[model samples]
Target: MKKSITILFCVLLSIPSFAQKTEIIVIGNIHQPVPNYNSDTILTILKSIKPDFLLQEIDSSFFNDDFTFKNPPKENEGLASVQYIHNNPKTKMRPFDFEGRNEYRKINGFNPTEGLAIKLLDSLYKKNKLTKSEAAIYKKYNDLLEPLKIAASKDAKSFNNSSNDKICEERQYYQYHKLLSIMQERSEFSNTYYTKANGEKISYLKGFQLASEFWDLRNQTMAKNILHIAEENPGKRIVVLTGFMHRYFIVRELQKQTENNTNIIIREFYN
Candidate 1:
């Protein structure tokens, strides 16, 4: 009887926990549709990883095939990969990102956040609201940014069967952030307060700040949504496909989350 008790105790200790261990894979991606990378590449890898749920950097509420037609990178690598996964009858689709421009609009309360700085500044220029020198500086900065944007667009294969999340994190860490820094520095409108033709003074910094807040808040919301997914679907293997810029912050947030009833395993997808 003592020997039996010992065997049973050992078996009990070896059994996996009932709460379920959740595996989360976050992939950083380039937004452009580079021809070298295609649906087959993504599909093959995802087929192996076999996630129970796949998340995207799209508005939670936005429905099928509507906005992509309006956007240039619509059929880009990220969305294409998502579409391939979602199209498979086997993969479950989950909404991850907050509502797009509307999310920012709601937060700022009577201000625009969706690239409004560039638009407003350009509009002001067309209407002769900005000085020639101001417009020139903005244009110059945009010109300087073209090369960086192209480099990021071409980095579609940064993630593959061999690399982990950290590899992707580091790759994008340089390219994406360098673009952001250039963008911010070029936003001279942020500091220079100018009067409209109507005599009301406006600062482009207001728009820049609101836009920045929108992005930061969106990231936080995304992390919270992941936590909710963990609680609702315990033991699920989830893969998040978002812009490379988001990888580091989301990974940091997920690391900070600790749950008693669920075990979380974070990794980069590997075949």
Candidate 2:
């Protein structure tokens, strides 16, 4: 009996013990205040989640040494987070946006127009610059995505849900990855030149590719920051509030972390 007891103790000591998994909810937020999905709506979500740490999509430089906004964040998520932190003094808010984000954007002359490649294609078609085949491709992509956009825009709640998250993911994937490739393959956009927001002229293909790469890098950085927070505070709940456009990228990146660590769980706001 004593020998058996000693062997069992040794076996127990050799086994690795796992820490409690940290719960992370990545909530998709709207930048501007919509009818139902305004600051108040986000505030309510923060209240319900009651996260120990709130990972905001705010650039580090945007915060003061004490973590208060330096010049007041422009996004609705930032606004709501401020109010939540005021109420829940214990909950900490951390900026997780990519460092040098503004400078990079400025240097790259990055503008929102880069994301409107589809709209640009449609304009080209209307202007009779694109061939019939190119026009048909644009029309097909637009028709498929328009209803989803319409449905998401109808209400703020509808826009932030998982359904909208999926739509946003699909839309971005097609916009940045598939659409450009299809157009190039069809020889539709090869000769096109797009004037960037900063008035620099570049091929439509290169401009979209650069924008896509930057977007992926930014989301990857955000995910890395969130993972660091989760690892440091084991078993705590962390809520990531970011624009709906970034929700899919950040969540997908975090999900990859779960596979190796097994100490992180990615969840949706509704879940």
Best by lDDT: 2
Give the per-residue Cα lDDT of candidate 2 at 45: 80
Give every collision pair in model 2: none
lDDT of each: 0.59, 0.75
TM-score of 2: 0.80
What's every prediction's RMSD, in angstroms?
A: 7.7, 4.7
Tens digit per residue, CA lDDT, model 2, 175-263:
67766765566443555566656678665556566777887899999999989988888788899888877887888888887787776
> How big is the positional error of residue 128 in model 2, measured in Å on the Cα after superposition?
3.9
Per residue, candidate 1 scores C-alpha lDDT tens digits across 1-271 of 9999999888866655444578888766655555655545556667677787777677645545532222322544445445655566566666678756564454453243224455665666577755566656555545554544554545344532233345445444432343234335555555555454445555556545555566567788888887778668767888887766677678778777754433787777762
TM-score: model 1 vs. ground truth: 0.60
Q: Pick by TM-score: which candidate is best?
A: 2
Runs in model 2 lying further than 4 Å from the true structure: 1-20, 110-120, 154-157, 160-162, 182-204
